[model samples]
Target: MIKILKYTEYLYLAVAIASIYKIITLWGVAQQETYIFIFFAVISIAMFLFRRNYRRKFEKRKQDNQN
Candidate 1:
C-alpha cells in the first residue's frame, strides 16, 4: 500500500512538472494554447488531490483491517 502511494506521488509530481513546462512554453502563444495549458494544470491538480485522498483511505482501511 505504501509502495502504491509512493508511485502515485511520483506520478502526480510528473504531471505537475509537465503542466509547468507546457505553460512556460505556451505563455507567449495565442489564447487558445494558454487556455489549454490551464486546463491541463487543473486536471493535474485534481489528479494529485484524488491520489492523496485515495492513499489516505487505503491507509485507514488497512489499519482497520489489522485491528
Candidate 2:
C-alpha cells in the first residue's frame, strides 16, 4: 500500500511535467489550449504535494503503531 502511494505521488509529477511540455509546445499555436494545460500543470503539482504529505503522515502513523 505504501509503495502504491509512492508511485501515485510520482505519477502526479509526471502528469505535471507532461502538461508543462504541452504548454510549451502549444503556447503560440493554440493559446486557449495552452491555458488549459497550464491549469492542469498547476493542479497536478498541487495534488502531488498533497499526496506526498498524506503519504508521509500515513507512514509515520504506521511506524508509531509498530512500536
Candidate 3:
C-alpha cells in the first residue's frame, strides 16, 4: 500500500510538471492544445488530492480494525 501510494504521488507530480512545461511552450500552438494541457493538470491534481483523502480513510479503517 505504501509503495503504491508513493508511486501515485510521483506520477501525479510528473503529470503536473509536464503540463506546466507544455503551457510554457504553447506559444506557437493553437488554443485547443493549451486547453488540453490545462485539463490534464487539473485532472492530475484532482486525482492526487482524492487519493490522499482516501488513504486517510483507509488508515482510519486499519486503526479501527487493529483496535
In Å, residue 50's CA in model 1 sits off its true spot by 1.2
The clash numbers for all candidates, in the given order, read: 0, 0, 0
Q: Report how far residue 37 has shifted in candidate 3, in Å.
A: 0.5
Global lDDT of each candidate: 0.81, 0.99, 0.83
Q: How much is the lDDT of residue 25 in candidate 3?
A: 89
Q: Which regions in candidate 3 have their CA more than 4 angstroms from the true location?
A: none
User: Per-residue lDDT of 1-67 in model 1, one digit per residue for the tens?
Assistant: 5888868876876877787788888888766887887787788778888888888898999999999
lDDT tens readout by residue for model 2, 1-67: 9999999999999999999999999988999999999999999999999999999999999999999
TM-score of each: 0.76, 0.98, 0.81
1 or 3, which is superior by lDDT?
Answer: 3
Error of 2 at 55 (Å): 0.2
For model 3, residues 12-44, the per-residue Cα lDDT tens digits are 978988997897789467678988998899888
Candidate 1 lowest-lDDT run of ten = 29-38
Per-residue error for 11 in candidate 2, Å, reads 0.6
| CA shift of 56, model 3, Å | 1.4
Scored by TM-score, the top model is 2
The parts of candidate 1 lying over 4 Å away from their true place are none
Query: Model 1 reaches what TM-score against the true structure?
Result: 0.76
